[model samples]
Target: MRAIDITAPGGPEVLEWREVPDPRPEQGEVVIEVTAAGVNRADVHQRRGFYDPPPGAPPYPGLEVSGVVAEVGDGVEGFRPGDEVCALLAGGGYAERVAVPWQQLMPVPDGVSPVRAAALPEVACTVWSNVFMLARLRRGETLLVHGGASGIGTFAVQLAKALGSRVVTTVGSAEKARRLTELGADEVVNYREEDFADRLSADVILDIIGAKYLAQNIRALNTGGRMVTIGLQGGAKAELDLGALLTKRASIHGTTLRARPVDEKGAIVRSVVDNVWPLVSAGALRPVVYAEVPMAEAAEAHRMLDSGEHIGKILLVR
Candidate 1:
């Protein structure tokens, strides 16, 4: 098998496709023959040596993949060779095959192509766990999502709307704002032109930009609001205003999907299968794919993600 190997801590050019040892399933794990892999900002971070894979995880950059089962380990039931599935991976999706815990696997939803299914797992698990489960976004509440045109952002916007929330999103361009509005966002703020904190208030905020938006995010939250920060695109360090949080009775949460215990990721995957899959099957939610680059050219895919111009996910197809 061959996988994308990071030659050094640097840019996308460092990602090299090279022959690697074939992975075999461990206890409760399954090996997948990859069809497609989702490209994420985290992959770029990993390539730059900013975020390393968790202990014992593969030293590859991908985090989600859609593939067919090739082998199952002992104790793995419900899946076998030839079964098509998508999985949330801790690492190693940028390969021809990857071994993953069976618990992290999900059957491709009806009507979705296996290639497109690759776009679902990471974004779905991230959004569902943070916005719905952790932040407790409720119907009729306003949910603000930063980086609205991103894979997670696009999914978050549609899912929140489907679940009956009013969606507000911040994007870098008017074109992105228009696209998100058509995707069901009730309000779209162009962050380049206006300040979102002064224009709107939200009961729940799904933020990707960390330090750059911290103070403003607090100010934008409605009383008793909950804000979940999942990415640090802006920076990691920021000064928090406890006084403002106390005055509004607001709460802030920071989370990451990778590096979590397998069982915890399994739980989130199950919840997504139960709560989010139906919406997808019914067409209320959809995977927004911006481009499909060849797996061997993962460096090109990484460049696409870095451009920040893509409206959704960029997939590396086998």
Candidate 2:
């Protein structure tokens, strides 16, 4: 089998595809002959040596993949050889084959191809966990998403809208704002020209930019608002105004999907399958693929993502 290895990580160039030992399913796990892998910003961070795979996880960077089951380990049921599935992985998705816990595997929704399915797991679980489960974004409430054109942001926008939330989102360009509106955003803020916090008050905010938007995010929240920060693209350190939070009765939650315990990640994956998959199957939600590159060209995929030139996900296909 061939897999990507970060050889003294520094940039996308550090990702090297080379022959590696094939993985076998462990108890409760299944081996997948991967067909496609989703490229994520976390992969970029890992390639740069800023993030490390959790203990006992594969060193490769991919976090989600769609593939055909090759083998199932003891104690695993409901899946077997030849089952087409996608999985939310802790790491090691950037390969021809990966071994994953059965709990993380999901049947590809009807009408979605394995290539597109690769883009769903990470974004779906991330959005479902942060915006819906953790933040409890209720129908009719105002929800704002930063980086609206991103994989997570796009998924969040559609899911929140389909669930009856009035969605608002911020993007870097007018073109992206237009696309976001078409995707069901009630309001779109061009962050390059307009401040998102100035014209919007949200009951729930899904923010990717951290420190740079912290104060503004708090100010933009309505009373009793819940703000979940999932990415720190704008740096990690920031001062919080306790007075403002107290007055608004608001709370901020910082979370990451990668380092969580397998059981916890499995729970989120289950929620996505049970709740979100229907929306996807019904076309209320869709996998937005910006590009599909060959698995061996993952470095170029990373460059495309880092350039921020593409909207939605960039998949690496076998």
Candidate 3:
């Protein structure tokens, strides 16, 4: 199978597309003939050697995939050899085929195509686990999402609004802010021009750009609010105000979708399959894809993401 591997630690240029061994299912795993893969910031980190895949995970970059099952291993049930599914993977998504644990597979929701489904797993699992499962976002509350036009942020906005929460977002441009509003954000702050904390107070904050926004995210929260951070797009090191956190009775939780256990991710996937998947199928929430690149152009996809020239998810079609 053709796969993208990091030749050495550096920039996107290090990512090389080459033919590798085919992925075969081990016990309790399923081999997916990958149709599409989603590009993410973590993929960039992996190429730079800042992150490594866990034990037993694929060495190549890729965190999620949409494809059809080609083979199933022992102990895997409820999925056949021809089922169309999407998986939240630990790595190895940048390939023609990938072996994913059965626990990570979920049916492609109605009205969603394989291309669009490729964009769902990472964002859905991330937003559901952090914003809804962890933070417990409530209706009538104000939710602030950093990187509003981003993959996770775009999904965060739609999900927040669908649950009847008021949505706000901070973005790099006026155009992106406007797009966020169209995607159900009640207000959008130009982070480059405005202070998000001063512009709006939120009952919950779903942040993807961490550290750089930590102090201000705390200040922007309402009393007894929850702030769930899932990324560190901005520099990771920052000071925190212990007094301010205690004063507001706020709780700050930092999580990474990829680092969680398989069982935990399975639970989250089940939750989405039961609830949120229907919303997407019903068009209450929509998949936002900016560009669809061929699987061989993994490096270019990474380049586009690092450049931040696009909005929403970038899907690499196989």
Candidate 4:
């Protein structure tokens, strides 16, 4: 199999496609002949040596993939060779093949192509777990999502709206703001020109710009609000105003999907397949892909994501 190997921690240029040993499934796992992989910020972090795969996981950078099942291990049921599926992976998605636990596999939703399915797992699980499950965003409540045009943000906006929540999002430009509003966001804050905290108060805030938005995110929270921080695009350290938090009776929760145990990831995957897939099948939610590049051009895909020139996900296809 050919996989993208990080020669050394640095930039996208360091990614090299090279021959690697084929992966065989362990018990309760299945081997997938990967057709497409989603590019994410975490992949870039791994490529730059900032994030490491969990112990006993693959070393490659991808986190989600779609493909046909090639083999299934002992104890694995409900999947067979030739079955098409998408999966949440811990790593090793930038390859022609990957080994995934059966629990993380989801059948491609009706009317969704396998290529597009590759972009759903990571974003779906991330948003559903953090915003819906953890933050407990209820119907009719205002949910604020930072980085509104991003893979996670795009999915969050649509899913929250479909579940009856009023959505607000922050983006870097007017164009992105318009796009997000069309996707069901009630309000779009142009972060470059306007302060998000000044424009709206939210009952639940899904934030990606960690530290830089910490203080303001608190200020923007409605009383008893819950804020979930999933990314650190804006550095990791910041001072929290305990007084403000106490006054508002608010709480902040920080989370990441990658380092979790397999069973926990499996639970999230199951929740997504059961709850979110139906919305996708009904067209209330959809995968937003910006570009599709050949697997060998993984480096260029990474470069495009780093440039922040794309609105949604960039996929690497076999």
Candidate 5:
């Protein structure tokens, strides 16, 4: 099978396409003939050597994939050969084939394409785990998302809004702000022009940009508000003040979907399949594909994500 290997850590150029051994499913896992893979910011971080796949994963990048089942391992039931499934992978999604644990599998919602299904796992699981499960963002509460045009941001917009939260987003430009509004944000802040901390108040903040927005999150949050930081795209380090945080009873939660305990990830997957998949099938929630690149050109996909000019998700098609 052909898979992407990080030739070395540096830029998108580091992603190398090469022949690798085909995967064989382990117990409780299933082998998938991958049709598409989602490109994520974490893939970029891994490409640059800031992150590494856990043991037994493809040393290459890619965190989620949509594919057809080829084989099912012992103990796995209710799915078999030819099932169209998408999985939230811990790693190893950047290949023609991948082995997924039964626990991480979800059926491709009706009417959702394979490419869109590939885009679903990472951001959907992330948003579900953070905003819904952890933060418990309530309907009618004001929620602000930074980098609102991003994969996670776009999904955050739809899911948060669907659940009744008034969504606001901070984007880099007017064009992106406009795009975010289409994604369902009630308010859009062009971070290049307006200071989000001063202009918009939020009861809950979902932040993809880290350190740079840290202090502002404190200043912008309502009392007892919570901020979930899922990515540090802007920068990881920043100055923080304890006084304001204490005063507002604000809490900043830094989270990553990958590297979570398998059982826990499985639980989130189950809940989302039951709760969110219906919305996707019904057209209430959609996976936004900003660009699609062939698997061999995964680097180009990475470049688009890094450019920050795109809205929604990017996919590496098989």
Candidate 6:
């Protein structure tokens, strides 16, 4: 087996593809022969010596993958060798083979190819958990997503619209705004030209900008709005206005999927399969893939993600 190893704390150049021992399934786990891995900002953080994998997880950087089951361990059921599946992982998807808890694996939705299935797990679970589940975004409500051109952002836009919410998103450019509109966003605000906060108020906000958008996000919330912060790409420190939040009766939540327990992840996976997968299968929601780089050239994939030029997910194919 071969995997992308981070040689040191640094840039994308630190990711190296090298031969590694094959992973074997443990109790309630399954070993997958890698097909493709989803590149994420967390992988970038991992390569730069931040966001270490949880205890007992693989040392690789990837957070999601699509692959074939090669083996299953004790206590695992309902899945077997040769099964085509995509999984949400804590780590190790950037390898030729990875062992994952069986609970996190999901069958590829109908009409989606195995290669593209690699794009679904991470973004689907993230949006479903944060926007729908945590924020309880209801039909007719407005949901605002930051970084609308990103994998999570793109998924969030489509899923919210498919579920009957009015979707508003923030992007870096006009081209991205156009793409988001095509993806079903009712409104797309170019952050470079306008302030999203001044333009609209939302019942729920799927924010990725963290500290930089914290104050503005509060101001953009409707009364009793819920704001969930999942990424800190814009820096991690900021002041919070308690007066504004109190006046609006708004709430803020901070969450990270990678550090969650397997059982918790499994619950989210189950929710996605039940609620989100049907939409994907029925063509109401779609995976947005911007590029597919070879597995060995994962650094190139990382560069693509960092460039902010892509409209959706970038995959590393085996």
What TM value does model 3 have?
0.98
- Tell me the TM-score of model 1: 0.99
- What would the per-residue lDDT of candidate 6 be over residues 1-318, giving only the tens digit for each residue? 999999999998999999988999999999999899999999998998978999999999899999999999999978999999999999999999999999999999999999999999999999999998899999999999999999999999999999899999999898998999999999888989988889978999998889999999999999999999999988999999999999999999999999899999999999999999999999998999999999999989999988889999999998
Question: Residue 6 in candidate 5 has what lDDT?
Answer: 92
* Model 3 misplaced stretches (Cα beyond 4 Å): none
For every model shown, the clashing-pair count is 0, 0, 0, 0, 0, 0
For 48-134, candidate 2 gives per-residue lDDT tens digits of 888999988898989999999999999997999999999999999999999999989999998899899999999999999999899
For residues 1-318, write the lDDT of model 5, one tens digit per residue.
999989998988889899999999999999999999999888888899888988777787889999999999998877899999999998888999998889999999999987789999988999988998998888789989888888889999999888888998888888888888887889998888878888899988888888888888889999999999888877999998999899988888888888887799899999999989988999988998898899999988888888878988899998
Cα lDDT for residue 75, candidate 4 = 94
How far does residue 165 in candidate 1 sit from its true spot (Å)?
A: 0.3
**In model 5, what is the error at residue 205, expressed in angstroms?**
0.9
- Location of the lowest summed lDDT over 10 successive residues in candidate 2: 7-16
Model 2 regions more than 4 Å off: none
3 or 5, greater by lDDT: 3
lDDT of 4 at 181: 86
My TM-score estimates for the predictions, one after another, are: 0.99, 0.99, 0.98, 0.99, 0.97, 0.99
lDDT for each of the candidates?
0.96, 0.93, 0.90, 0.93, 0.89, 0.94
Local accuracy of candidate 1 as per-residue lDDT tens digits, 1-318: 999999999988999999999999999999999999999999999999999999989998899999999999999978999999999999999999999999999999988999999999999999999999999999999999999999999999999999999999999998898899999999999998999998979999999999999999999999999999999989999999999999999999999999999999999999999999998999998999999999999999988888899999999999
Q: For candidate 4, lDDT tens digit of each residue in 8-51?
A: 99999999999999999999999999999999999999999999
Position 261, candidate 1: lDDT: 100
